[model samples]
Target: MMSEALRIAETFPGYSREDWAAMVEKALKGQPISRLTTKTVDGTEISPIFERAVGKAPLAMRPQDTTWAVCQRMDHPDAAKANDQVLNDLMNGVNMISIAFAGSAAARGFGLAAEKDVLAKALNEVLMDLIAFRLEAGAAGDAAAKAFSDVVADKGADAASVKVSFGLDPIGCFASTGALPADWAATLVSTIKDLKAKGFKGPFITVDARPYHDAGATDAQELGAVLATIVAYWRALEDAGFEASEALGMIDVVLCVEADQFASLAKMRAMRHLWALLLESAGVDFLPLTIHAESSWAMMTRLDPYVNILRETTACFAAGVGGADSVCIVPHTIALGLPTSHDRRISRNLQTMLLEESNLYRVTDPAAGSGYVESLTEETGSIAWALFQQVEKAGGAVEALKKGLLVDAIAKSNEVRGKLVATRRAALTGASAFPNIDEKDVEVEAVAPIALAVPAAGESCTPLKAMRVSEPYEALRAAAKAAGNPPIFFANMGRIADFTARATWTKNFFEAGGIRSLSDKGYNEAAEAVADFKASGASIAAIVGPDGLYEEKGADFAKALKEAGAKMVYIAGRPKDIMEALSAAGVDSFAFESCDVLAELIKIHDVLGIAPVAKAEA
Candidate 1:
């Protein structure tokens, strides 16, 4: 007897790739097939369709079982408070804790003090053997690790049962802060030897690519950095009396997961594939790769912060489905201040829902065997491998940083990303597009100021700057919020049905800059709109209507609004043919799709006598 899938397959003859292309071209109505393609920042081309081909190998596979640790970040400055939060998280669904030490690159501006007394107090009530612990202590990782070991000893837990990662990435610290505190060789050897002597049988070194990612490196660049950093660690460990396999077993990789779901998934798979290839080339047996993914800090925004929940949820889902061994979801309000207890709960529950309700982790390599994912994984891995070769030729990751090669590449990518954000090519829901002007400000607990570490004065290089794509738009919105009262007025030119769409668009556009827009209902006469515009007391007025109506009454309405004391007049639609006449009648500008929204908002702020505050440089 034939099964259902077998019968269905036999009922249809498979078409060739060319046959599929022909059908797609016909459906496109003579448009070129290339129009359906998109180019990513990493120089990879994504096509609308993909076909299975011979000799295309599958990427590395994840564990078959549905298991991934729900890791939560603990960075409260007070030891007791941090301990309380850790217990609460453990009592909930969280199974892993990542402690950020003060002055670590991963700490950003928040972490617990890295002292023995503080470490003991922070782990007082927690059972070290039951839950996994990962430390992000940057250059101070060795000290933090010793302190953590002391805490475990005090609790009398068997050291063999403890699972932890002493996240020690000296090269990462150098890239982040632009200074190497001590001799890299001495530090690496001493840290590893101390851990081995203490029977610490966990990942001791972290090859963190998050510094590069936060500094605006594309996916390929970030992967290249990770590979290069890992290779450097392997060489250092071998020199310090460890074999290649042992060194590889003692290291782990950390990657940043953002809101792009498919890209994030493919990136994780590509990293594993690249690692396998690297191990094969080094003549070492393959080992399962350990990857830790954290929600992207560069994607979080201070304005309309509630939208960050959606972003974090998507990132967490990607990390889980991408086969990350563990995932951390940063609080939605992290960019503003210390996250409140409620915000922490929201962040933890986001991963819980995705794991328990959505069952995202139930599938092993869910994207495998799909033509699109397979192609993406291959192309992404190839690009990263090539970049790794370039770094190797320039004398490894540290030398590449010292020579400013990696810094220059990251800067170029950052510039391109900034331009995209400015033009709204990269949309930020609450910060750059569709912002709520009347939304109340979010309150958060007060956070302590960062205590910066003093560098020990070795070789120094240019630091990679961390940036948020929405920061520019956020600055403009901040200015508008402080400018007081309604900032703009909408001059509806026709019946409700005629002007509603464009009027709504105009209102949303201005509101994205945090400018309150007072919209009037449909008005028949130019005199009525002019009267309403003057009564609203808004200096900036937008003319909203249909194309036919704009051609009919746009000129008169613009002239009347200027005469009635509107400092600046803007038309919602871009009627190119009548633009000359409209401008002559005092329509200063037009706002439409694909226009430079950030530039327009800045101009509007200038005209309204609102000066934006100086933004902090990334």
Candidate 2:
């Protein structure tokens, strides 16, 4: 009553940053503070503790409304079917529709046909004045824009009331497909003029950075690409006789929201900060940055498609809390095939639950003033701004791509990420860790194959390839499944306590590659284990035991399994001192913590006659 704030302030002494650090250090029991630091993929070191930001400008103003638009991607090839899906989505909860056009690089070979008839059919019952529409037409964006305009006119909707985005990103197309269908400058001029003539008020040109993000770019690199592309568009628009402010108003930013929730949230906030700073530098009055956040395709997996639900949920939450103007949650079964009605509904409802049930939309800039998030936002923004300057120095985004500078940088980051995935340093649930070998194939609608646009002659550049982190491991699983999920027998040496841990580890390890393990109970003798292994008809047998037991009997057990018809013998634990003896006695390899899981699985596949399918060179 004297005032709650005054009471709390009187009860506790204010703690300084150093004081907090001292307490954390003391709690660590003399461990270095650096031990608590985490290095992000972008090479930014994030400390565990952060003091309140001092003399730092807020990233962006809080949204006037707490809620964000629940956007859904509508990419079915059949326009009628797409329209049905759209109506269903809107009726359920979705307020925004992203129309992905066939042959758009962002569509990854799946989308509605880019025709006026198809556009009209897809938007047949959609209320243009109420719901938003975003077009992703890639190289054909200009054509698609005209078609959409025709549909709106035919629908008798007021053009000014319709919330639509042309989704024109020429640099994104070039980076994705290694070429542009038309000259970049010519395409931009024509598209901008057409939209301006139509009197469209929505952001017509989209500066999409998804190509970079899906290509395995770090947060800094993705943000840098967006900044560079935004600047490039501004310069182009000015050259095409548009005012700087008008050009800025015509553009929007689209970023990928991935499974790393905190990182995703930080990235969204950082991009807003970067854009505000860019506009401030240009002396343009602040215009609200329109951002469209979509769940990352690179994080989806075909092996365990259901896990993608959790991934997309976290992504949607991050986008909403991070202050995205709109958020699109990709269907969980997207990687398997064209998403079925059920798949789309589930994804859409998850967003609804987050907004309504969870009430995530009740706060604007939810992460604002949080020490860790603020620190991450600042660090991420600083790195991104520096990279943006590098692009400017190398001539803007187009020149950077033409010179292979952007592609090379992204490839380097991809190399690091690829290594992390292969070694299991980065865990992909149900793919790289705790995989379910008996997982049923996800059912999806049977749709026509995606049609990709062919690049025209004399229009070529280095393309940044998009890849999923689970592909390599998924390939290994597919190979094993193709081989009828061959069994790997585990020869448990000694009592249950002596071998259970290693046996479980070995079973999960093989199952991660889709190879089922028939694990036998404790075997006191090598002959008994050998008999069980032979009876199980397993081509591969793993010797599982504690280090002490391995030192004593691992060699004899490996030799026995080899004699009992095991094509290869694997040791579950890594006892370096006894490795030589076990190998000499017929142990083929050892699976242990920190080992290269992908490489080891491939080797096992080779020994079991499971030939992996050839992968195309990126």
Candidate 3:
């Protein structure tokens, strides 16, 4: 058999893979150093994750052959415009539709215009056979309750296999509006009972945990919130004289899967396992759970809005691999304003591409059975399960919510996450670093959060409204342009072994940090390099070559560069007398093999305050 085939055979050998892993670890660990190490918020020791970390879980589920529905969100100021958007998105591979209210007027407009009966009739009439519906009960006030039930019943009349999830919870409502009706729980219970009695097999009771996640809850905490919320519903149903199985059957949930692909993937898988465990503890057998995964709103950014596509893609991929029944990719332009019809179509298309072209939906539980993925699944599931149990023992999710324990735990997790961001352990692309200057401030008709009659309802939308500060583009651009022809110089003393790899790596490292390099083929002679540096007015020079060159020509090269008027020179490897020679030559800084070049570039950027600019037109 081929070597590739042999490697596969080796992985599934008769003995435990742990033995091989141990041997590999021993071989890999040739030396140990006292470097700073960090741990996850849950106190789990953070280690480099690879394919090897996955072990012994279900590798992939075969029946996940069908792609999930890509839902396009509609929240326009006008009903006809929103309806037109819904039609366009549905035609363009959007199998699901989520309607959100941008304002109280918007919700009222949708309610009054699409009038409970007319709206339900139109929704029932218009939604194509393949499309499902999600109603985000905005601040429609008294009209919300009737509109919700009417719409669900309308979908039911056609016997069309469409999903209808009404984000109807008194606590969620209270959180948004700070006005909870006295009959909030009673209303919800009645709605769930009504849906089930009407033979609606779709997830009738959606536990919206996105609020908790957007509020900065950890994955474990988010899962805990979901479970606790489910438990709250379970207790409420039981108090309403429902059986365990009935309550379990009525429960559905949505979770916020972030851009941290691996963690989010693990979180999704763990969610299923956690739900299974919760049901088992409740003396209920397996009941199918439907989970709708949304991209993390907290991680969305206004600057470099294009990067949001990358974020949403990974979030969608993670959700898909983690087995979410449905995944919603929010538009990149959503942060600026009410999303355009085009934006919604593109967002929906991302998932369509993943499923249809990328073949992501061909396998269920795709990350299963890997040593690392399985380990993460087990670990995350176990931790979340424990938290769920704690929440249940505290008299369920509602009690925890009422007493503020759930919020308190989430606050603690957010604090840790905040510290991680502050300390640079967790870097937010485009926002924390690599900010965009030419970017425009996004202005959109804001989606005023539906006020829930509860505490923390609007907390999820706070980050959305916060203004982001970035340096003015023209000023920064002018500064960068003024700095002009910022130096391109490389340091090499003489012919050296492995010159190719060293140069390639150095060039790559520099380019990755958004700096120009002065490397090219056939520039081998030190004199020629020095001449080019002089001709180009190079201010900084980097020496990347073998130690032999440093030994043979270090002193002479330093002396020559100094006489040639090079301001800063960096030597790749340590010379026999680098400090002495550089100090003698009056060089600004000397970097050895142990130096971190990226860190060095950051330092340079700080000192110069020189932003990057497009090369000036000749």
Candidate 4:
């Protein structure tokens, strides 16, 4: 093949790195180039531009190929329905299925029964030898694993040929549930020994990252946690008389992908690097480790679930592009309740389109050679390895969790990110930004939510509960619905054109906290606006206009709205040196970009006498 330089176009002007920097400085009006750079949660510095590299190497995939399993989640409570969905998915496009049992972290609150007869029914008429089963059971890991083993044994299938990931993750279970059936180290060793002895040639044990990831672990922390978990498990398995090669072969790696496509892709690829590094340090050959991904449940939103489809598509595509071996595309409506069959089909179709239509699985290591992504992978791996060493020094993931090191880290990071979410700094499209107050409800099945009990086995720690980014804002929206969508008067200070932009922004801004915007842009006089504000029946009001208009009539409008029985008054835009005057004239607060939106909304709820809505989902 001819190189690009060899066939260069003679008329095109070439630019060097210095030329680009000079141009950027001029564009920034003498500002430093560092202003264009940002940092990730792991403290990796990200530049706005990158130069082409002379030499780079591609990271190898598990099988040096791009084909991945189109896996769907099957969590219907009825065994017959689960079986029917499985058959339908297989018939349509899915070749793999994940069975999330009741009380498991995977399904949130709905899942199948963990019994042999029910398990058999769930697999009725399906060929075990052809289809792969990924288990999504938590704390009930023992019973669910044994029941599936019984299904494999009694169904006359060749256990050696059946593809199953039992997904017995005791460390992950303990992290989530805070209780293990017994001492976790011994339980895991005995369970592995028992499963291997049962003649199930398996990728039986998993280092599931969902618990820590959902609990708000950063990307580097997640990769580090995965590395630490794999090391801990292999050490235990080797001590239990399993060969290094055999132990490595028995392990499956699970991760979560979110809407941040580039970061998610880099995180997935970084896991592979961490896995290979672990093997190299152990003096074992690189083994095939199946990386299964579930699109992050913590990233899904109940308020605008159709937006969740967009999130799931981007996230699932990243998983495929980063060469995941299998992926479970969580239904868009799962956060609401048990998803309908149609909803399940929509999720399956999304994955199928990504694979067959978009051909995302056709290119192996799609992110391997790009300078930015390669550097991202390196930085992510380095920081993750550093954190993994810290975990090892603290006696690995289990000990770190017991001593509260990991949980504390999660707390500190989540607290920082929570402030971001609370303000408009971290804009959530449907919930905290431009929300759809009139969005019709998306229907979900009317199944009762399940509460799975995890029996205490004398060992316990503080559990890491899962959370979503949009929960706080969504709760306010739910409360607004209960309060009958009370209106907030938008007291536009000047003529329509002068106040349109700020008023529109104010409308979007206030509605984010579930308060509807009752805006009248044509008001030419403060007295007329006050009369309208009184007649509009809104208890609160915001004065919005251009800076000049705000300096002119903003204080008068605030005073008028308050005098017209508005419980609280606000003005948009932090115009310089006039906030004291506005506040004295009855402006209670200010609303602008990067303000504490959740806090302000909660205050609005209190002023409106609306009760706080409890957290609705489990």
Against the hidden reference, what TM-scores do the models get? 0.94, 0.93, 0.67, 0.96
Give the least accurate 10-residue stretch of model 4, judged by summed lDDT: 53-62
| Candidate 1: residue 3 lDDT (0-100) | 75
Worst 10-residue stretch by lDDT in candidate 1?
Answer: 53-62
Candidate 2 lDDT by residue in tens digits, 1-618: 487767877888988877888888899997767789877878888887777665554445346556788889888888889999999999999999999999987776689877899889888878889989899988778778889998988988888888998898888888888886656777777877776676678688899988899888998899999999999989988988889888899999999998999999999999989988998998998888899899999999887789999999999988988988888988988787788999999999999999899988777786877878888888899999998999999998888988888888888888888788888889899999889988887788887557556456346678887788899988888888888999988888898888887788778788899889896688878999988887888888888889898988888899988888888888987899989999999999999987888888888888778987665211
- Output the number of the TM-score-best candidate: 4
- What CA RMSD would candidate 3 show? 8.0
TM-score quality measure for candidate 1? 0.94
lDDT of 4 by residue, 1-618 (tens): 977688767657998888888899999999988799977766789998886544666567646545688899888899998899899999999988899999887768988878889989999998899989898788777789899988888889888888899988888888888876657667777776787788787787889999889999988888888888888888888888889999888889899998989899989989888888988988998886789988999998988889999999999988988888988899999888889889999898998888788888777877776778888888999988998999999998878888888888888878878988998777888998789888898899888988855757566778898898889989999999888889998878767888888888888888887899986666667898888888889999888888887788778888878878899998888886898998999999999888898899999999999988777884
Per residue, candidate 1 scores C-alpha lDDT tens digits across 267-298 of 89999889989999988999888999999988
Native-to-model Cα distance after best TM-score fit, residue 345 in candidate 2, in Å:
0.9
lDDT, residue 148, candidate 2 = 92
Q: Residue 67 error for model 4, in Å?
A: 1.6
Error of 4 at 591 (Å): 1.0
Of the two candidates 2 and 3, the one with more favorable TM-score, higher being better, is 2
> Positional deviation of 157 in candidate 3, in angstroms?
4.1
Score each candidate by Cα lDDT.
Answer: 0.85, 0.85, 0.61, 0.85
Q: Judge candidate 2 at residue 436 and give its lDDT.
A: 92
Candidate 2, residue 9: how far the Cα is off, in Å: 11
